[model samples]
Target: MTARHRFDPTILREYDIRGVVGITLCEADAHAIGRSFATVVLREGGRRIVVGCDGRLSSPMLEKALVAGLTASGADVVRIGLGPTPMLYYAEASATDIDAGIQITGSHNPRDHNGFKFVLHGHPFFGAAIQNLGVMAAAGDWEEGAGTCEDRPVLAAYVNRLLEGLAGVDPARLAALRIGWDAGNGAAGPALERLTARLPGEHHLLFTDVDGHFPNHHPDPTIEANLADLKALVAREKLDFGVAFDGDADRIGAVDAGGRVIWGDQLIAIFAEDILRRQPGATIVADVKASRTLFDAIARQGGHPVMGSSGHSLVKAKMKEIDAGLGGEMSGHVFFADDYYGFDDGLYAAVRLMAATVRLDRTLAQLRDAMPETFSTPELRFPVDRARKFAAVGEVHARLAKAGAQVVDIDGVRVTTPDGWWLLRASNTQDMLTARAESDTREGLERLIGEIDAQLALSGLSRA
Candidate 1:
């Protein structure tokens, strides 16, 4: 008889199963996830699964335990050992017979934390599917049989595929451009080093060694402070632009020749311009936190602009539903359903960015300068009790509705004004409320901020 298992309920999240290792998550939880997930796959008539792990210290142990449960549950496992989360997504997307994929990754979290991201039949496995896995684990209802496991190293193939994004890019122009890349010693390091080696350009790389400790810096690039090293490198080398990736290489960050950080919305704007040029009137999606300038820019470029909910899974679903050519978020997850798979891959985004620059006949700095000026607050995250975050958004939404304010409540409450817009939403991944405001002028921006503060006060909270 097989042993029964129960996972810590808190480890199951909106988009993935995550927790601090040894505290809320362990090898046992990993095994339970594999068994339960395999059972679910089998119920759906799926028989093969792909498993991948990051370079974290805890990943190997988790992967071992997970494979045991998966094989025991009668699912053939293709173990793509030691790669980024996107690599797992690629493996599943590219496989002819694979039914599911799971990646053991800590993402951009601190060293002590880890988690799993999943894809089922080429779609994100999240929300209710995550909760169902917990229920199945608790019931000890899993398939049992002897299943096979195979080892496959796919880094070189993945890197080669990324280069395909540069098909129409001018090679002479690519060679003329100097670029810098920083992987922050995360799982994306080795892949980045391999990618740049074959690309056309004067290339320089930083911290290409896989170090889960992240001794150089935290792997998250969205936070401006974490990008200090990359910015310094770009400046020192006078590169045309610099690119960086989050821990698992799913999120991207960039800086131009002047070492100015390019926000995610701005990156999408660049991508939209290039993509819309070829596929006119294509639907392009950006999350609510994206700058209004991005939406306006997409429209000006003859593309349909869509404001999507603020989560990668939600955005991906929306993209498929609308057959969107491109979709992205302010947090740096760019998805391309145009010429590539509709999954968020930072390395792929970087490749497309290079192609965009070369094809447009403009350097990154020139592209940045071409955008209209807008004053926007950096994403503000304030602590709120987990239980009250959603309720608070609901409360704010009611008041806005009552006042007949011009608002968009797709994800949260985004009030639009003659000056600009302000948004308040509960973060899906953390116990916090996120807010942002943007305007054409400083005074208008202040008004938008004040509106956000006023809305928060109504919920008996203060921005921190």
Candidate 2:
């Protein structure tokens, strides 16, 4: 009989398993996750599972333990070694025989934090499925057998597929475009380095070395501070545009020629315009946090616009339901189901962005300039008690309903006014309430902010 272990309940999250290393997550927890996940896979008639890890310092040890647990449960393990989370997703999607994939990545979290992202038969394995794994582990109900393990090299092939996005792009225009890429010393560094080496034109890359410590800067690109280096490189090198990837390279961030940062919604707008040109009336989805301009832009391009809940898993699931061509989040997670797998891949998004620019025959800066100017507050997140968070959102929802506001409450409350729109949603992954408001003018924007603040006060909470 094998010894069964229990994990800290908090580590099992809504979308994936994540917790601080050593304190909340450890090698033992990794082993239990493997055991439980493998049992579920085998019961579903799966025998082979693909596993990958990021460049984190603790990943290799956890990977070894996880494989041990998987094989112990009689599931064959195919280890792809260290790479970005999306690379593991690519491996699973491209491989016909693989039943599932597990990528051990921290994913833009602090260095001390680590987690697991799963895909079972190309669909996200999360929410209730994640909770069930915990239940199975605590009961020590994993299957018993000795399974096989092997290593495979798929990086070169994956990189080649990414380059295929430029297939129809004008060669001369692509060759004329100079781009800068920053990997932020995360798991995607090596892959990004290889990608830029093969891409057309002069490609300047920064922090392409895999460093778990993230000595240069934090791996998250959603924050403006993290893009300073990439922006400077673009300016100094006079590059046409720049791209940045998060820790596991699932999220993308970019800067135009003038060093102006293009938020995730803006990038999706650009993608929607180009994609709609080819695939007329395709559906484009963006999370509720996205700007109104993005939705309007997609509609103007003859594409259906969908406002999805925030989170990669939610966005991906919604995309599948609607058969959308493209979907993305304000957090930089972009998914493309048009000509590729419906998974967020920062490196792939960057390549596609470049292809879009070349195919559209416009400079990135010029395309950005053409968009309507809307004053908006950056996404504002404030800490709230986990137990009280949902209750607070409920209170706000009731208030808005009593007031008869035009609100979309699929995931949260997105209220619309004559000026523009404002969103207040409780984050799925954290004990935080996030709010964003946008308007055509400063006065309208201020009014929207005031409304958000008033709602928060009604819920006995105030922005910090």
Candidate 3:
């Protein structure tokens, strides 16, 4: 008998498979994903698959079902147990025996949400690849055999690899720093605990206990509200700086000694300075949503700056294409191929940030203070009809093109005006239209935002 499964249409996102657990996604879906993915792997002449899960309560059940599907398809499964998404990436990237990897994580989403992220043959498996899984599952197009599953813990090795980001830093300067970390009770907790134990400095950790309910706060560090705890921790401890991680610990958020939230692009600028110093004229990539200031900073340092489409997987693909030494996003997904593998790892970013501070001989706050001042709106996401979101952006793009506005449409429409810039793009993961604007003056920022509003209004929508 052939086995066929149908996924909830909404779960097949552009970057990964995600949905609200028990509602739109379930154990059966996990099984189908495993079976389908394993079939693809077998077709590619690969048999070994690595899997890991986050701290979510539903992860264990999904992992069990997923493994069953994989093994049924004759794919050998190596389960890395519980850890951050990067740990799964690390296992796959470092192991010669591994052919592909998947991480069961909800990322920075709400507690009830859960999903899977994948890497195959050292490349991101997403977009069309993700959609094909659904097609294969619905057709029951899977190989059959009884393969085996085994557990191999990689947390220790993963932590050690993260420490390598600081390999050349002076131990004395590192020890002189005082830092704070907020894991937000995500999968990074255990790894953070282990890394901090070996790191030099006075470290204060918040929400390191893995709690699926996220009793204290949500794990999304990009949101200002979510960083309240981290900010308070830094202020109370008088630490040099603080770093935070999202649910699966792939995205990062930070605060300096004065407790100001350092946005993602600003962090890239800091990293770019150090990296360009070592590898001059190297290409540095940043997503379209990043500030113009960051692009100029990279260029000023004699580094080539490339604007990438937003989304971690897309940025990673672009980085690989351009052979970029560093890449990042406004959402805090930083990738480093200079001293480490080109993947977004929050823990590794933290270590590199520390090393940068030590080598530059400047406080984190000082590095932040040196960035050009620009007033910008945070990512403004508003719900739109799933079918209409992309259309709306297209309409805006066409209108802007007709108007002869300076536009960069690498991902969406980023209008570069005399003020600064404004971006309008559809969210790849959700049925929402995301917008952002920046400028040197408050008045200019308002005008840029007004332009965004006008464009959205023309598309029969409004930020309100």
lDDT of each: 0.92, 0.93, 0.95
**1-464 per-residue lDDT for model 2 (tens digits):** 65668889889888999999999999899999999999999999999999999999989988999999999999999999889998999999999889999999999999999999999988999899999999999889899899999999989989998998888888888899899999999999888888888888999989989999999999999999999999999999999999999999999999999999999999999999999999999998999999988998899889999998988999999999999999999999999999999999999999999899988889999999999999999999999999988889889989889989999998889999998899998988889999999999999999999999999988889996
> In candidate 3, what are the lDDT values of residues 1-464, reduced to their tens digit?
89899999999999999999999999999999999999999999999999999999999999999999999999999999999999999999999999999999999999999999999999999999999999999999999999999999899999999988889789999999999999999999999999999999889999999989999999998998999999999999899999999999999999999999999999999999999988999999999999999999999999999999999999999999989999999999999999788999999999999999998889999998888888999999999998999999999999889999999999989999999999999999998999999999999999999999888888889988
TM-score of each: 0.98, 0.98, 0.99
lDDT winner, 2 or 3: 3
What RMSD does each model have against the real structure? Answer: 1.1, 1.0, 0.7
Worst 10 residues of 3 by lDDT: 455-464
Error of 2 at 122 (Å): 0.7
lDDT of 1: 0.92
| Candidate numbers sorted by lDDT from highest down | 3, 2, 1
Error of 2 at 420 (Å): 1.7
The list of candidate 1 runs beyond 4 A from truth reads 1-3
Model 2: ten consecutive residues of lowest lDDT? 1-10
Q: Which is better, 1 or 3, measured by TM-score? A: 3
**In lDDT terms, how accurate is model 3?**
0.95
Q: Residue 229: error of model 1 in Å?
A: 0.9
Cα miss at 244, model 1 (Å)?
A: 0.3
What residue pairs are clashing in model 1?
none
Q: Give the alpha carbon lDDT tens digit for every residue of 1-464 in model 1.
A: 65687888778898898899999999989888889888888889998999999989899999999999898898989999987788899999987979999999999999999999999999998899899898888778898877899998888889989999999778998889898898988899888888899999889898889988999999999999999998999999889999999999999999999989999999999999999988999999999999988998899888999999988899999999999999999999999999888999999999999999988889999999999899999999999998999999999999989999999999988889998999999988889999999999999999989999988887799996
